[model samples]
Target: MTAFEATRAWAEAQDAADPLRAFRDEFHIPAHAGADTLYFCGNSLGLQPKGVRAAIEAELSDWAELAVEAHFRGRLPWMHYHEYVRDAMAEVVGARPHEVVAMNSLGANLHLMMVSFYRPTAERSAILMEAGAFPTDRYALESQVRFHGFDPSRDLIELQPDGPGGTLSMTAIERAIAEHGHRVALILLPGVQYRTGQVFDLEAIVRLGHAQGCVVGFDLAHAVGNLPLALHDAGPDFAVWCTYKYLNAGPGAVAGAFVHERHARADLPRFAGWWGHDKSTRFQMGPHFSPTPGADGWQLSNPPILALAPLRASLNVFTRSGMARLVEKSRRLTAYLDWLIRTRLDDTLDIVTPDDPTQRGAQLSIRVRAGRDAGRSLFEHLERHGVIGDWREPDVIRLSPVPLYNRYADCFGAVEAIEAWVR
Candidate 1:
């Protein structure tokens, strides 16, 4: 039978047997023409968990009734609200409770991390990263270098792919480190690349950077909820991530930061704020800046409770689902998508995501080979046909089937839509 003819039956069978099938009901899937859209854009913005509304409403009710007393008397208690999700967030990122803190947005947290970790001297002043990192990371690294009185052009070392439609290789990365190891003060890279969906070897990079006397960190925006990370054991100097994508937190949700325990007590310099001050005596309005120990010390301001409640709701699902199980399903689902795209649409699409499952996450970035406008045309057609995937400028379509809410059937529907569109 043709690819289109067998696709639905196979997908339905897979969905029927999937262990994580129940998770699809936990999220609020968007509808188009009275049917659930094949929502596969979890790498960009996650579908809201059904529990989010009630979670936020509870906070709203507490505020309406308790007013200023909410700080002490609310159900979650505003003063310690950020602490409620600490362990859950830590569990998601494989960090020790003391080493992780849910805090400001991704960019702000990255800047804050640089204040403590990106120290540069005249002798060792270069920062290294893979070329085509997410734009914000590029900006943060460049600004941090410039802020330290170094020229970005000279101090920034970006490792580029050796061939067209390829990703940075570990050999190239290590070679760059060996070449500029002494001058590279900070080595910041993504846990999973934004456009190509390449999962870097964080542990290896950490070991290599430390051996070269460079501080290492990760912008884990794509990796946190999508991959299994052992941040504490992997031993990066620090890491930062946003919760909105795979975490199922709403748009502009509170982000998180991880600082290794080795630096927790170091007399490192940081940009401090009232909330980062010792919580026990914060209400006393002390003139001195005494930071809370561990990653909490990096927090700059009190977090917004409404923004955090959804993260709590999403984390509850993760606590139940377990990372190993989610990752197992993620691998299988992504592999299936890869297989379908190759067998059914290989003539029109090229998968830029790493072919090795171990080197990628849930996303598949497809480069449209049909024509210049073909990628956008197909992406829009998929949307019109109730398949939701995101488009990257020029010629790529990004689709991530989150194990938490996406099903084998959703994957089938997305490819079917693409097939229909191409025809």
Candidate 2:
């Protein structure tokens, strides 16, 4: 890796040589003071892709011309709208086409996956998850435990970080599963930790949990487009993710789910709905429910064509850029940001995200050393100076340099703004 220099010239040089630099022009950067804001908030909501409007408008045109017939007749036909994005989405997440599907929201998909994979016997009913997981995950686990006639306090195991610098280690994770393996029915974790920006080893987690007779799953909301994943080979029972973050999909876009190919014919219990019925006989109105064999079998209703159009557009961008290339750039881009902070704002800020690039994505969760009030002030200061980053509750401010659209110059400019606030 090249050593980073804390200068705008160095930043511009990196951006000048960046092969992915042209991709930045594809997004609509938010404005501040008559110029584009330094957007480091793709970890929250991604900037709108310039192609999204046309994507949405295409569907609208079909609707106007074809109406109800548009389901089977259109540029991209609504009947199999989810399928339109499946191959590209699978490519992004590293899964087979049949193994991935664009469907319900993240929370809803989590619940549906839990229904099939969280079947608990009296002897093996506990769920092991990381401590301080996102609130939505925590709530879902709690409710699932209660619904199954178990006490969450006793059945839910929150794994803590025992590695150096308060990060979870493979040793710690292995030890936790070993100790709780006998009583654990399921293990759910994030591909990337939301608050700290720690990327877990998905393959290792699957190996550990499966070795212990546990059904493992992942919430990849933070990992999906930010990192290249191999969910198929990693062999998780299931994985769920939202497309709006690093995917550059619009707000509240339809989410996705992945089910391993091994479960294609398994007689697992699932929440049945009409949309999941066998396509060949779906309109026959058969009284019996026969699921569509793969991840698509998990659908509860027909996909929202309009919501999926933007996702289609965004996935096309990802397809064109390729995850491997994007990730390579992400490492360098984030490392530049890290370099700037260490050199310029070390006295006032601390990076909660790991220094090791492999252990994180594009996001760097920064902690203000001057305390919460000072942190809030610093965040607002950055906002005033045309820098856009998100402040998590308490003290951390998340700055993510998305490879698809963010440049090295954005990282440098953002750090400069933070330095000004400190001065």
Candidate 3:
């Protein structure tokens, strides 16, 4: 990588050279003061894909034309709507098609996965996860622990971070697992830590958790679309993610899950529904339940086609651009943002996301040097100036330059806004 220059010309040149630069037009960047805002909030809700409107309209047309028949009629029939997204989504997450399924919201899918994976024995009845996990994950885990007739205080092991910037060290994780191996029934962690933008070692975590007789899983809300994942090869028992972030899908888009091929045939206990029954025999309406093989078996209800339409459109963009290329661009884009922040705003900001590019996705969580009130003021200033990043409570301002749409010049513009505020 060349030394980053803190100039608009340098930023434009970088953008000119970006192979993924054209992808920026695929999204509908929000307006501020009659121009496109420098959108740095893809880590939260992604900007809507331009194709999303057409995708949903197509479904709406079919609904009007065919009514209930739209399920089997239409350009993308509702009967198999989830299938339309399965392959592209699998490629995005680096999993086998059968191992993945588009389904309910993140929290609902987490609970469903827990129902099957969090089987606790009397001897080994604890759940292990990183401390300060996303509140939804903590809530799901705590509820699961209680549902299993165990005390969450006794059974939930929240591993504290020992690394800089509150990042978890693999050493600390291994040590925690080693100490609690006997009591741990499941290990749930994030593919990327939401607050700090720290990327966890999924493969290593899976290996360690399995060694400790734990069923491993991940909440990839921050990882999916932001990071290139190999969920099947990484070998977690399962993983879940919402499509709303980094995917360019609309808000509250249908979520996805991965259940490894190893469990495709396992007789695990699950909360079953009509949608999960064997497809060939699904409409047979038999008394006995026979599950569809692989992750499809976990579906509690049919997919919501309207919510899934935008995902289909967004995944199509991903399919065309490719995850590997997007990630390549992501590393460079984030590095540029990191450089701009450190070099230009070092006096006013402190980056909490790791300096190592491999340890993070696109997000850089920055804290203000002047303290929380100052940070909030700076954040408001950025917002006022049309730099759309997000403020996580206390002091951090998260800026994620999504590769699919964010430009290097956007990064430059954002830092310039910060520098303007500093001046």
Q: Write the residue-wise lDDT of candidate 1 on 270-340 in tens digits.
A: 99999998888998998999988899999888889999999999999999999999999999888888888
For each candidate in the order shown, give its overall lDDT on alpha carbons: 0.90, 0.92, 0.92
Instruction: Kindly provide the TM-score of model 2 when superposed on the true structure, using C-alpha atoms.
Output: 0.98
Put down candidate 3 lDDT per residue, 1-423, tens digits, no spaces.
688888899889988988888988888888999999999999999988899999999999999999999998778879999999999999999999999999999999999999999999899999999998899999999999998899998999999988887789989999998999889999999999988999999999999999988999999999999897999899999999999998877788899999999999899999999999999998889988899999999997988989999999999999999999989999999999998888877778889999998899999999998899999999999999999999987678999999988888999999889889988
TM-score of each: 0.97, 0.98, 0.99
**Model 2, global lDDT:** 0.92
Report how far off residue 69 is in candidate 1 (Å).
Answer: 0.9
Candidate 2 lDDT over 232-287, as tens digits, reads 99999999999999997889989999999999878899999999998999999989
Candidate 1 deviant stretches above 4 angstroms: 1-6
Clash count, candidate 2: 0
Position 282, candidate 3: lDDT: 89
Rank order by TM-score, top first?
3, 2, 1
RMSD of each: 2.1, 1.0, 0.9
